[model samples]
Target chain A: MDGMVLVITSGKGGVGKTTTVANIGAALAALGRRVVLVDADIGLRNLDVVMGLENRIVYDIVNVMENKDLPVRKALIKDKRVESLFLLPAAQTRDKDAIKPEQMKELCEELRQEFDYVLIDCPAGIEQGFRNAVAGADLALIVTTPEVSAVRDADRIIGLVEAEGLRGPRLILNRLRPDMVKRREMMDIEDVLDILHIDLLGVVPDDEAIIISTNKGEPIAFDNNSKAGQAYRNIARRLEGEEVPFQSFDNPSFFQRLRQLVGMDK
Target chain B: MALLDFLSRVLNRDEGSKETAKQRLQLVLVQDRASVNPHLLEELKEDLIGVISRYLEIDLSAMEINLESGGGDTVALVANIPVRQVRRSQQK
Candidate 1:
């Protein structure tokens, strides 16, 4: 089966790139598609911890790249929770320059043959790390928050990504506070889309459950009660070529009232 | 005073921080995406001053040239050249 290599990236740090990668990888794996999460942030690796597979990482991407004797499969750590999910963690000691872009491309080419989805967790900034992360990818998912700085960086990254020949990168707007949006204090999804001018894959509402899940080394995608989890699930389904309606976060109460009026709330 | 402040804020909902953020992002992204080099802009300004100086006597110090967003994917080169006097010479 032909597989897809998708890079999860944000030009600015702390914009949920890693979180989005972990959750989306897990969600896709839960869909029974074999998925491998590659942490491309060499020195500042976080996808391993985020995936809760830090202890299982005996060999990382650097090990596979530097040691000609090491096989790529040996470095891959299978997820404890999801049967089809795997992770190739980045080396904490090595810097971004440790692996070249060509090597990343070769690695992705090999992984795509085995896994149904190869999700690369890209580092922040448009540096060597970012280039290496995107080198082998067939598609890109730009993650951004509603904040001005994040949006600005995302715009720059979008240009850079398109320049790299990866056209039409989908967007995932994360950490959106719908209450603040309702109060006209936060940038809504439309405002962000107007600036970024990309097809939005999904929007994840700011949920406290995300923090709890992250701290516990678990993805919120498994938490059915969390709205953010539901959002990730919808994104995964969208990736799988399914049409899922976006959840209305701005005024759920209005929808609820309408449902009640139509006697559809039973 | 607090009540009046709240009432004023409520009345002027368009002046919310979200609008400010959106406007600021739109303005900034236009400049960021334009990627116009400072050296190029300076050269352009000098060339503009040389060309326009023949047509009109302009104040060089007060002049400002900037790239502004003309809404959605279009950028405008805005030049604010204060004209001190117009040269009405028949000579080429």
Candidate 2:
């Protein structure tokens, strides 16, 4: 597990994989560890925008692979907020075929020598983009919502990740509502776990602050004040193999008490 | 009984309220990932009945086959393929 290469992927789109990469990278960097966030999305890259470094992108992953003259340090985009944080952007103009899996593995190896953590922001869909993104990764982080579709896609991705000779594709149940799970109107957290059966990393309660931060191109994890932000930070700590207890959603309605009484049903 | 107890606590904590739209969306997603349409499962049941009854003397009406969503990667098939010997009385 030394010099970890982690890929954040979900077969389904819009499950917040890029957002996780941005926030986790920021949090890890803030902890004084050298971190590189690699956007493997290629043409559909958004990690640059999420990290508010879209304008600074001159050379991308493709450029570094093709342009032998460009140095790795030059392609690394250091986060304005954190000194240890950096990003290797995807080529927005070219397609996912821009880089091969072997090249990605080489890049990750080069990055592993310099950075403590290399987090790949994987693109959705199980095609070439996914193959390239997961090529050099030591671990996989499956991002899903409490919903069934995301979980299903996550499950599919989990199989693929395992098939590729990887390990520990932990679950991050995002956009969960504690209030909804209590009412038996939505699938409980337990139900989702039963279906996917992966080790739980952390749960992110859906908050409006995530949208606000996304719009501002400032990651919520940098805020350190929002609940969702805390969730992401906690996940980062967990990724570093630290044991952090989860915070409850703080719903004390009669039914929530009952759900707890019954054994945390969802 | 444990599941029932757990659900009761969930209901009691949330004041017996129903699920929100987002939750329903998630549930639908899970079903979709399994490629399981309830209608499709029913059709499969009917077709399985026809195929199994064509030659065998088994109780087709008692047959049961289920498709479960195995997380996100697989479509697990759980089938109860019961068979019985063909008695000579029906051979004509």
Candidate 3:
């Protein structure tokens, strides 16, 4: 197809796959690329809710796949805020096995014709849903946390994705607490990199703004002051073939905080 | 000196949670990649002893079989069996 297909997956749940999809999709759309997010996690669909388009999803992906007469455009929900962004919400009432891998691949191939990026938000676990998500994609992004269990699951998922013949499923380390890492209470980036041994895509710090954004059904990538938003923006830039330096997770200096307090910094 | 060192260790508590996690992950990943359980490693060690005893009088008490992470994305099966004595015919 003309556009690239990227599957965002984490073998373990709650590692920020949906959040990453929402933010990265918004960031890319802001960069003037036509981006369509396909929520492959059928039974547990939340991409629409995360993007505040839950009310706009009239026709879900399962309806499109189950009915041959149904056009793909009918299920496509265009973002009211972003000009080039769209989302194909998953079927919450149906089970994950309701859609097959082949069907998902055909849908993605069809999407790739009209968009510059077709990002599939994969479901948790190495089950049918995971298979369906990766079937259509030529590229993969494995989301993981610094915790041991998450990293282990991510390693297994990476092996499975590579076995599928997909190329360069880069790593996105999520929910990294810089203060805990400095105090040696949590795993540092260096230690995680040593074990995973994959190219670093981007590191998102644990920010409270993320939860607030999710609650409001808005992506933090739109907030210019949010650190996590800045990280997602950088990741979008990198995906556009730009060499962006990794953001330092260092805690804000006292001077910087003082500057902010005095309304001298934005 | 021993008492002072003990006091310092208790007071400093330098090693953090991340170090413990790293150690645990390294160990678990090695075992996972090698697909060898603790019981299997012991059984393999016993079988090696049975085969090697025909030529050498080895110290079974000092034998160790460990699954360690090696260089270049590989897991190495490390076997350390102490040889106490050698048979005459097998000597080179």
Candidate 4:
């Protein structure tokens, strides 16, 4: 089957790159698509723990890379909760230098033949790990928060990603506090889009449910009640070529609504 | 008293942290994204001085060249060169 290889990356750490990979992979699998989450973080691998598949990793992507005879299927650990979802754990004992970009490209070519979507969780920083992650990908999804440092790094990453021939990378603004945005204490969606100048895939509100889900080794996308989960689901649908309207995070006041109705609000 | 407080809060909303963050980010990114090589700029400056010296004498010490963000995706190459004097003869 022809598959899309998407690298979920952020130049800055703690921006939810792995979380996006897990949720988007799980969401895609729930939609009956065969999905595999590849943790490209190498020594600092945590996607397995986040996906609750830490105990199931007998072999990892490194094993497949070293042993050319080893089938890629043997290294893949199937997700317990979601059908058609799999995880290719990164090697915790090794570092980013263990794998080459060419090997990653070959591995992705092999994976795309079997899975519908191959979502790679890129490590933070513009080092070798970042290059290896994007080396095999057809598209990129940049993750960033509504912060100064994160946006600046993202701008640098955008230039680097383009230099590597990956064009039109989409942005995923994560951990946005709607209440803060409403109070003008946090940057709004428009403010971020203006600086980044990339097409936004989706916006995930800062929800406590995400923390709880991480603690439970579960993705929020499985929960129907969580707004963040709904956002992930919407992003999944959008990835499937579906046009979905973004969810409004602001709880507009009566006067604000009236202003909007009268086209008086910017 | 409560009504007055609410009005004050609404009126001061524009001076919130959001605007500060956006402005700061924009300024920082302008420098970060302006990865134009200093060596290239120097070479360009030399070429510019050589060409302009034929028609007008410009001070080399006072020249300032930089790449500034014109908001969004555009970047402006700003050059400030002090003209010392104009040559009287037209150079072929």
Model 1 captures what fraction of native contacts? 0.93
Q: Can you give the TM-score per candidate against the true fold?
A: 0.84, 0.74, 0.81, 0.85
Specify the poorest-scoring 10-residue window by lDDT in model 2 chain B.
B14-23
What does DockQ give for each predicted structure? 0.69, 0.19, 0.62, 0.75
In model 1, pairs of residues that clash are: none
Candidate 1 Cα outliers beyond 4 Å, as residue runs? A258-266, B1-6, B11-14, B36-76, B79-92
iRMSD values, candidates in order: 0.7, 5.1, 0.7, 0.7
Off by over 4 Å in 4: A252-266, B1-14, B36-64, B67-92
lDDT for B82 in candidate 4 is 98
CAPRI quality band, candidate 2: incorrect
Q: Which pairs clash in the backbone of model 4?
A: none
lDDT of 3 by residue, A1-266 (tens): 49999999989999999999999999999999999999998888899999999998799999999999999988899998899999999999999989989999899889999999999999999989999999999999999999999998888888889879999789999999998887677998789889988888899999999999999999999999999999999999999999999998796799999998999996
Clashes of 1: 0
CAPRI class of candidate 4: medium
Docking class of 1: medium
True contacts kept of each: 0.93, 0.33, 0.77, 0.97
Worst 10 residues of 3 chain A by lDDT: A180-189
As for DockQ, the candidate ahead, 1 or 2, is 1
In candidate 4, what are the lDDT values of residues A145-175, reduced to their tens digit?
9998898889888888888898689999999
**For candidate 1, lDDT tens digit of each residue in B29-53?**
7688656346667888999988998
